[model samples]
Target: MATTTGTAAPELTGLPLLGSLLDLKNDSLGTFLRARRDHGDVVRISAGPPGLRATVYGVFSAEGAQQVLAGESANFRKDNAFYQEVRESFGNGLLTSQDEDYRRQRRLVQPLFTRRRVDGYAAAIATEVTTLAEEWRQADAGTVDVLQDMARLALRAVARILFGTDVDAAVEIVEKNFPDVGAYVLRRGYSPVNVPRDWPTPGNRRAAAVHRALYEVCDRIIAERRSSGAAPGDGQDLLSLLVEAESAEDGSFDATELREQVLVFLLAGHETTATSLGFALHLLALHPEERKRAHEEVDRVLAGRTPGAGDLDALPYVTRVLKEAMRLFPAAPVIGRRAVAATVVGGVAIPAGADVIVAPWVTHRHPDYWEDAERFDPDRFTPEAEAARPRYAWFPFGGGPRACIGQHFSMLESVIALAMLLQRYDLEAVDTVVPVASAITLQAAGPARCRLTPRNP
Candidate 1:
């Protein structure tokens, strides 16, 4: 065990009463980056007025991230306000569940995400990609918003895979209502003070209404699945698998639990993967040399065939491109946790019950780990290079027991989609800078427009 220096970690200077709240709200990603740059890895960030003030210990180094997320994961818990906000809106699914509930959920859900099982969904993913490609091919305008299109594509693909026959209903509900829910979570998650959720304020009422609609759609589909008596062995969709998942110790998820898990899958599955795919294409479009390498790898490995699970390993360069994109723009830019007890991390003493965050957004760009950190270089992820870096240096899907369960599925979906898209279109970025905001997830706040020219044209 390492001893702390017995000194306070550096703190970012802020307003007299509000601390870092305004800066954080206005530009969270930039604020975090500035924190790391100005105050090293362990920086104390206080927010809100003194009465309701929240102070977070920002751990912004790969080693610090490893300590918080993986090494001493038990010491850092998801009991913070941000997670509570997410849980209230999204339900106590795997993402926000704790202790035994998390363990049980993990055991039941783990087998469903096994490499072989996740790989089996490649055809469904390819179908969505093909649909998008055809739409782009027929469009009179050469440009499209990659961020928006990829979100729609990923939602459709995951919805189809999860709900199967009921995909149309699930997609319609999510497409119409999820943005408001996400916005609500982000706004409340960060604000130090909030109006009571039951007060029927405009935001509260809208959020409540959307939550009910989301739950109702999911409950109806789950009910239909139950009525259909779909066993996991015979059924191909995720909902069926969840319906059938059972154990002697934990039995199975009940109706509400099932809805919660479905909601988690719908939110995490599409959003993170969509972020990866959108940014991967955007990065490639901006860097011609990297794009050329990706194109060559896709063409050579795929050879005029639609990308599938088997092609994942063959397209090494394409994988690296995706990895590099993730490094630059991790889907979950900042992850929040609360220290269960006093702990020493990166030679800084974090007091018990302190709100802590390990920022992949900063760690992925840590000066010690990444040379030319701002550059979009796929070669940074080559096998040798990856081995030389810390494990948490590129944690886009997070780390530890609480890590995102859909990681394999996200990668598989991204690789197949990127390969297929690269094979069909030559891309050029219409917007040079894709302004992003750290929302519930890392979101492209502005348009990520890209011009596509059919390769054969």
Candidate 2:
């Protein structure tokens, strides 16, 4: 059913069954690598559609991804089946919304991620990471799952920067309904039809309940902040900004809309940061020279003091290593887009309603684009070397009009956090590490256990 960019449909082999099994096995990246090796840049597979089938292709090529994300952006929409799967968990959130709604919502929220705003958030990020690191220092040292710790860290930063100082309690609120929200997607077996919460299975029931909890907590924060009459754009935290950030055209978000915005921040923000941070640490630990360089950069730039906003941009080597780490193991490893209208991209005809997956994991490692593509080499991103490479070859945060809105904030936050940890601690995988891929993000299967010894006196 699937056809190449050229008019000729690929000769049907056993791929329909083979591809289906590989995908159902949930090793999507592995499947992509196989196809890229078997076919060229463009590979077509039967996805059970009648006329049009999904295309598994590369986006790591700087020119190729740019064309899809920027040049021909109008042809794409975020409303793909993959995103639709999580519709209940994130209804109209920025990551999945389409067209006019997406634009309006994005415009309303853009101010939160501006350089000035994110720069101000430096102290908050530094303080949070320091507190967490201090607590870790006080604990018995052996192995720690940096994933959970990083998740908590990113969430707390969100609390201070987005929800104000009150984000700690909301974690439980999200946990309550997060289960059923997944049944809408992650159920061992699930039905799409909406059954009443009470009548729904336990997972669905929990999903509905947790969803309410999320809304209520958001509602409370919005109500409290609005009632306080805080100064407009004070940048106290995210909740206040949502209450105050007025678009030049629409004025400001309604209370109902603000709730959706909070949910958007919660869903879009945390996991990606956490996953990247963990993988960065994993890479540094596995590649000790890079870890030492990152540490030395932090030490040279900030001395022994905690890193602040000013220190981030100056920590060039640290950022490069982190960039390489992300390039090797991008947090949002795979991103999919569907064509809402027929379009031509990479000189290939993309028909309307076909799924387009541009995987950073596969593309970032494409042999043609990178030297020693599989090895960990942070120096490859050095300024001179970067200039030599094509532009879209390494997009950890993606690019173009619909690119990640929080790109700056996330980078600032990530750099600061990594500096804090590297200054004092060394971490690694205790045993062989196996990465597990899921509907949204990539996670290491076991505890990233490692001996965390204090730097020599």
Top TM-score prediction, candidate number: 1
Candidate 1: which pairs clash?
A: none
Give lDDT tens digits, candidate 2, residues 1-457.
2233544323213344343444635666776666666665655554433343434434435666777777777766665656776554666667777788788888888877788877998898888898888777765655666767887788778767877677677776664555346545543212223445456687666666677787888889788888886677664887787788786685788888777778867766777787778777777777777777887888888888878788877999888877887887787777777777765555555667877767788788888888788788988888898898877788777778888888888888889999888887876656447466645666566666455766632
Q: What local lDDT does model 1 show for residue 58? A: 97
Candidate 1 TM-score to native: 0.97
Determine the C-alpha RMSD for candidate 1 after optimal superposition of all C-alphas.
1.3
TM-score to true structure, per model: 0.97, 0.89
Give the C-alpha miss distance for residue 212 in model 2, angstroms. Answer: 1.6
* Model 1 Cα shift for residue 421 (angstroms): 0.6
Show the lowest summed lDDT stretch of 10 residues, model 1.
Answer: 1-10
Candidate 1 accuracy as lDDT? 0.90
Q: Distance (Å) between predicted and true CA of 439, model 2?
A: 2.0
Candidate 2 Cα errors over 4 Å, as ranges: 1-5, 9-19, 48-60, 175-183, 186-202
lDDT of each: 0.90, 0.71
For residues 310-426, what per-residue lDDT tens digits would candidate 1 score against the true structure? 988888899899999999999999999999888888788999899999888989888999998999999998999999987888899898877888888999999999988988999
